[model samples]
Target: MNAVLRVAALGLGQLVAIGLLLFVSAGTVDYWQAWLFLAVFAVTAWLPSIYLQITNPVVLQRRMKSGPVAEGRTVQKIVMLGLYGSLVAICVVGGLDHRFGWSAVPAALCVIGSALAGAGLVVTVLVAIQNTYASTTVRVEAGQHVVSTGLYGLVRHPMYTGNVLILVGLPLAVGSFWALAFVMPGIAVLATRIHDEEKLLGDELDGYREYTQKVRSRLIPYMW
Candidate 1:
């Protein structure tokens, strides 16, 4: 099967699973804003993959393993998924609570979280446009060349940075402390992956060391 087909299958499966669970068990819905936020998010997250599958299957097919390609370490991948799950759980539970007229602390987190998640997703789309992914392992193609302009000019791994933003934003949007638990571990995993990924690029990828020198920051602006 092609990359587009594979991605479509996965995306569809996730949608179906989540939809069924929410409908059959949870039977809950958030505010209209939450639904709108989720719609935008789902589209942004999957649209790029769909585009890449059609436009650049080579990047999608070149995986580190016979599975989905992640930009960083495998452990980080699991952690990110966990964090995202927490975000969803928070949304579902919080939405339920809100519907039941339960009180929540720090009301501002809802608005802030939505903004962060939405903004982070926009960044994610931009990174998707700039970076290429493969099926086996992380790599940039021979002619793909490192990007040192735009967002890359400041951070070596803007995608990781964006990922963190969304990871934290999801739980914040739902206003749940339980969902926030994954942030620290997620950050730790991302840090390790960034370090290891840079080391790998320094060794395997051409001119990546110099790129790092020029960028000066891994995930932040003007700082390490």
Candidate 2:
């Protein structure tokens, strides 16, 4: 599909998915937090998507890919499934929290969460702009090279850095403090995925090993 059409499809899919998920989980449409959360999530996600479509439609198309990486490793595939599953769980739990008043997340926290998600989206777009080979699946693309500039200079996995930030912000945005616990395991799984990515890059992409040495950090600066 074309880039514009792809973006439109994805955006529509998100609205439908979020609307259904929230309705199913919360059992009502009266939850203001869910509405706010969806708005923030949709706007942030689509803004970057549109930017990528304009600047690098090829990368956006690659990001839309659905399949295994080069190795087609089953374990990694399971981890990917688990990650997606956890994302769904997050919304469900958040809806339950809102329905039952499980946790009284303050308005301030929700605002902060929205800001963090926005920041994460910005970082993600920046990573995509810098690294043309940053596909959704973990693999070394044809003619792909290590991107040591911009955010990569600080963290080896800057795209994942954005993901980490989003994970932290999501629970609060959805009005579920307890859902934060769910984000941690996903982060750990992503760490393993990053390990697999780097291993592949070091073997297949020249200079990646050297870049890793220089950066030292994978998803966080001056740490990890």
Candidate 3:
């Protein structure tokens, strides 16, 4: 299949799946917050893919080949599973929170969450534009080198930084404080994945070790 077509299919499928998960768990279509969250998510998620497809098809192609099955390392596979599971859990819990009125998140907070999520999406897109070798799966591809400019200069794993924001912001955007509880596990999994990825990059990719030293941060600046 063509990479563009594959990416489109995968993106559409994921969008539908998330919609179903949220609505089905919510047991009603009257959830305005869920609708708003989905709209924001769809735009942020798909627009970046389209941009990447136009500017860097290789990155999009690599991203399409993601999830646990695409991971070569056992630890990476486990991390991917945990990450995906947490994402699903967040959606489900958010929906359930709405169904049961678990928590009443303010409209202002929902707007803030949407903004944070959008910012994270932009950050991820910027990372992809700057680092052509930014594959979703953790592996040092052929001719792949450490990227230390732009966002990479700020942190060794800017992509993961974006991911953390998205994971944390999504639940709040959906108006589910209960769903926010799942974000921590996803972050822990991401941190573990980053650790393993750094080990691999340091061992296989040249100059990665020096890049880490120069950057001095993995996902956050002035901390960690």
Top candidate on TM-score is: 3
Identify the candidate with maximal lDDT: 3
Give all candidates' CA lDDT scores: 0.62, 0.79, 0.85
TM-score of 1: 0.71
Clashing pairs in 3: none
What TM-score fits each model?
0.71, 0.92, 0.94
- At residue 72, candidate 2 shows an lDDT of 67
lDDT of 1 by residue, 42-147 (tens): 6765666577678776554452133223546575466446544554565565555445545464757676786787777677667655665422245545565667
Query: What TM-score would you give candidate 2 relative to the actual structure?
Result: 0.92
Question: Which lDDT value does model 1 have at 173?
Answer: 64
Q: Candidate 3 versus the native: TM-score?
A: 0.94
Question: What is every candidate's alpha-carbon RMSD to the true fold?
Answer: 4.4, 2.0, 1.6
| Model 1 ranges with Cα > 4 A deviation | 1-9, 17-27, 30-34, 59-108, 133-144
Q: lDDT per residue, candidate 2, 61-107, as tens digits?
A: 76667443433667678778767776778888888887888899999
